[model samples]
Target: MAYEFTKEDLKEIEKLKTKYPEVTPVTLPALWIAQNRFGHVNPEVQKLVAKTLDLPEAHVHGVATFYTQYYKEEKGKHVLDVCTCLSCQLCGGYDILNYLEDKLGIKKGETTDDGMFTLNEVECLGACGYAPMLQVTNDKYVNHLTEEKVDNLIESLKNGEQPEYEKIGMPRRNNIK
Candidate 1:
């Protein structure tokens, strides 16, 4: 199927382009808008972005594929990105990853049969202090995770609820005061 960018999307992309001296930098945000509109940026959508900016399709594809956050294909409603980087690994990130696999009955990099969740083994989400954490749909970070907490998270999501947790804001600079 052909992908069409909404007029609003084009306008947004236009606005973003103006912020940069050249159109190359606009590729990232354009892909973001495409993903938000189409839920994913497959080849066709990448082409659309490239065409919209009058750039090469290969360039758009490269940018989109470079970021793990961008879904190249259609994904489930909820995506679970298990962080298994250095800090998370030391804090038993793999254990959490395995736990989710078993609980969801799907291995890492697989989506649930019910089409609700897609589990991913990601490197880092920049929350080393919140080790053993998994990001919910690239939005919420469930941190300091344990088996019980994971269970609660699953239950809440199953019940059509977004599990809420305390967000650790960026550390305030001591020099500010």
Candidate 2:
């Protein structure tokens, strides 16, 4: 089936567009809407976004590729982006990452067989003080991680529980007036 935005998604896009003088500035929000609705911003989704924004496909694709937050292909329900920056590294971030890999039985950048989790070793999540942190689906950050905590997190996620996390840094500006 051909990809298309839902009515509500279109409405949200329109609402977001109102914040900008022209559609070009709406690219990020539009791509975000597509990713949130469809999971990942695939080529087809990029094309649709390009069409919606009246921009070239390459332009949309470039914008999506420029940001690590935008997944270009299908990802698991939960994506764990572990911080491997200097601060996190000093705090044993790699150990936590390796532990996750061993526990999940999937290497970094690969999804589990059941498609529940995907692991990624990402750059700084801006939680230098917290260190050893991971972000789940841009929703929350798991900070001051321990192996036991990682185990519990995996189990909780496997059980469909929204585990509470100790957020690390200041909130990102996702909503612009």
Candidate 3:
């Protein structure tokens, strides 16, 4: 089926466009809006975003593909992005990744059959000081991980629980002003 944005999405995009002088600059935010609503940026959604912003489809494709944050395919309910940077690697990041794979029965970049979780080995999550950390669905960070903690986290999530996690890095600057 051909994807199209909702009326509410269009309104949000219009508001976002006002922040920038040109429509081209709204590409990233528009793409983010699509991802936020759809959980991923598939080809149909990419085309929708491109048309909405009046940019070429190829440009949208390039921007989406260039960034790891943009998922071109469908993702699971909870996206687990494990940090594999140098600091994290030295602190048992690979071990944690392997453990998650074994526990979830899916390899990195693959979603579980139940669609509960997707694993991704991502670069620096900006919490190098707190090695062995991961981001959950771009919302929360779990740090100083271990097998026991992983088991507990999975069980909690399976029970439809939103477990609270500590933030590992400094706060991000979402606005210039």
RMSD of each: 3.0, 6.1, 5.5
| Candidate 2 lowest-lDDT run of ten | 163-172
Instruction: List TM-score per model, in order.
Output: 0.88, 0.91, 0.90
1-177 per-residue lDDT for model 1 (tens digits) = 779998999999999999999999999999999999988899999999999999999999999999998999988888999999999999999999999999999998898889899999999899899898999987899999999999999999989999787667777788986
Q: Which scores better on TM-score, 2 or 3? A: 2
Deviating ranges (above 4 Å) for candidate 1: 169-177
Query: Which digits, one per residue and each the tens of the lDDT, describe model 2 over residues 46-70?
Result: 9999998889999999999999999
Q: For candidate 3, what is the lDDT?
A: 0.91
Q: What is the lDDT of residue 4 in candidate 1?
A: 97
Whole-model lDDT, model 2: 0.92
Residue 47 of model 2: what lDDT? 97
Off by over 4 Å in 3: 167-177
Q: Give the total clashing residue pairs for model 2.
A: 0
- Tell me how far the alpha carbon of residue 69 in candidate 3 is from the true structure, in angstroms, after superposition: 0.7
Clash totals for all models, in order?
A: 0, 0, 0
Models sorted by lDDT, best on top: 1, 2, 3
What TM-score does candidate 3 get on C-alpha atoms? 0.90
